[model samples]
Target: MADTFAAIATPLGEGGVGIVRVSGPGSLNIMKVVFKECPDKVEPRHVYYGHALDASGNVIDEMICIYMRAPHTFTGEDVVEFQAHGSNVSLRLIVMSAISAGARIADPGEFTKLAFLNGKLDLSQAEAVIDLIKARSEKPLSIASDQLNGSLGQEIVAIRNNIKDVLAQMAVNIDFPDEDIEQVSCDEFITELKRQNDRLQSLIKSSEFGKIAREGIKIALVGRTNVGKSSLLNGLLGENRAIVTDIPGTTRDTIEESSSIGGYPIVVVDTAGIRDTDDVIEQIGIERSKNEIEEADLVVMVADGSTELAAEDFEIAEHVANKKVMLVINKEDLGMTAAQSDIDKLKSIIGCDTGDIVYTSVKTVKGIGKVRDAIERNLARGFIKSDGGNIVTNERHKDALVRAKAALVHGIELLEMREPLEVAEIEVHDSFQILGEIIGETASEEILDTVFSKFCLGK
Candidate 1:
């Protein structure tokens, strides 16, 4: 029998309400002892108004409590919850009362772990619960929610089923060598293996976009001094997050802020203008800017449209020549000093054959939308459309898929070489096992511990 586990489910702060959760066989018994005005037999799945009590039967707080019976609860066991005023002290006291009533404090993520162990959720769905909690934007939330709803697990199940069918065919060939059982030909087995391999490849391909959706992309604004980099940052965020001025080198350090474009989260970084400076502090800032450019997912090269291209502009362009770059010609309202010919010359100088160039005036906010669209387009280069399909978002899932793909490829090669069906079966079995790890069907205890340990308590 599992020990009853209790935890303060809400954050340790004041809110509208706080919840103390209990799960296991002893949950209702502990609830009966700790809640005042309790009936001899509590109705399952019904909320009851009551007051929490201490060992001396003194009222701890006015509360509402609910009891859910076994097999239908989060952990497939008896579960209870006490909802009380959102006071940290009161919540802790309530949890202590439950502890005194024979409910032990739960470890981090123990509740969800129990849910996984009890067959209430698969490994993927259990992992999705944490992703849902940590999601920072709607796109990530949507993906996580879909995974929790079993989209990814269903796809994995289908692939595994296909592999199982091939294994079955191989088994028949081995078990009935002299019988008239029709054996699966090498070509047929290879065809099925290749189909599954292609599916896994597609999933692996989606991981990049899924990662961007989950963690957001980092974009660094690079340019010479006084070219409206700060202004463009403000425009993208639709707020004044950076100090803007006509004086050069006003922003000596990088300023980072979070915003979303086209439903995707983005970290916009306003970097110091790239230039040769004698000031020690400015030099440090410029070095940091170079480092930021190196680490950025994309770089926006801001140029002054109101003035002719300078040596510094060319220097900046050359610095970011190999990076994924979008050229923004700011201050277009002031009249164009750098025309298309100048842009062509700048591109030639940078050795970049093609780039997204947007003409904008940060002062008038013209063409800001164009710049945003260009960013979205660049990021979506190889991104697979969602279309209600399973996307591999977690690095663990991607690694497993890669392993599975390699095993399948090896199996196909063996088949093409006319190796014994039994020999190729080993590789196919390995692929199946690798896929099973994704849903915890064959995962080791250590992997389970590592995954669940990242979850917050009471989840």
Candidate 2:
């Protein structure tokens, strides 16, 4: 049976050029039969200019072909790349021609899947390829790139190796009790297990911050009607994405936009101002704003600095007490009627301690940077250290770390109870397996399939 597959690598659209990538055992053979070049035989890793021909010996198109032999190719198999005319119809015809000459269409992620199966890449490294491709922010890209380069994979392997070594020592101790096999004492086992457990727990703690970094934080702008929520959003975005008007309830729905703050991606939401209203559209908007406020990771309560805090302000304060609030006292350009004393009184009434409120004039673009800094501080709480360092970014790694940590704790408990070396051995074995899964040392076919399925075709 033919072990070759082909697909158009580029996205289907008008482009400068298009490419058809083929891989497998028959790649070079099929290229020779269908391509009129190189004396009817193609050498591996050589790019050749050629004319693609059909079964009737008629020229279909002029193209460029490159052959990559097994062991050095992406899929660890023979590979060919065809640069043909930039047309969907032409590319499809080329693929069909290769199929007729004995190649099958590659399934989604099949090329990378083959690479994983062939030992070219581990499960985590394979996953990093997709993450790198889909990364929307610089931080995510950096994290994914590090993972692809095997930083995360290396760490996992190291942890798994440590656990496996401990298990092997325990196995020797259990089988050859008389032999001086450097048997691990109960106290030593407990101490070592706790050490690894703490390390694993630290990694697991980073998962939340990693998620926020991957998926931007959601910030909801909420306040009483006519409080300049839209103005603040536009000021932060540096564009008039949200409509601004003097009339209350002008913004009848939520407006969403993305921006980078302190190297973190943040999705800012301009929600309709909350207030009592009878208008049908206004009521609907008010409801959405409530939901947005409830779901927000950060809430910016925009209050009019020109007036004293009202009942509505207190209501907002009560609603946002549970959320991370950055009290924005906007319209400082309006000649502040509320002085520091008034702001302090408002803070007291809102039940917020000092330092949560920010004085700003959106019209003049003041204090916007501080707001951004505050949002980043909240989002980056537990993930990064003071000097800025690497943190765990994969959910699988985080889960494995958690499981390993738990197993280590169990091992520690067994050691404290002075149980048989075999008892501690079982818990140590469990921890070893958990760490192994992280590095693919003990991962099953189902896990591998699920991880690689996230990749795009021709990866």
**Candidate that would win on TM-score:** 1
What would the per-residue lDDT of candidate 2 be over residues 1-459, giving only the tens digit for each residue?
437998888788777678889999998877876687745555777778888876566677889989898889888999888888888877878887888888888888888888877888877788888878877777878788888888777877766667776777777777998986667765765666676677677677767767877777789998888888888898789999987889988999989899877666778999988878889998999888888988888888888888776678778777777777777888776767756775666566555545667777777655677666655665566233333434676788788888888888888788788888788788788888878777677898888878877766666
Q: Rate the local accuracy (lDDT) of all candidates.
A: 0.88, 0.78
**Cα shift from native, residue 384, model 1 (Å):** 6.1
Candidate 1 residue lDDT tens string, 65-125: 9999999998999999999999998898888899999989999999999988999888999
Cand. 1 TM to true fold = 0.94
Candidate 2's clash total is 0
Could you tell me the lDDT of residue 394 within candidate 1?
Answer: 92
Q: Model 2 lDDT vs. the true structure?
A: 0.78
With candidate 1 superimposed using the best TM-score fit, by how many Å does residue 171's alpha carbon deviate from the native?
A: 1.0
- Residue 336 C-alpha lDDT in model 2: 74
Lowest summed lDDT window (length 10), candidate 2: 381-390
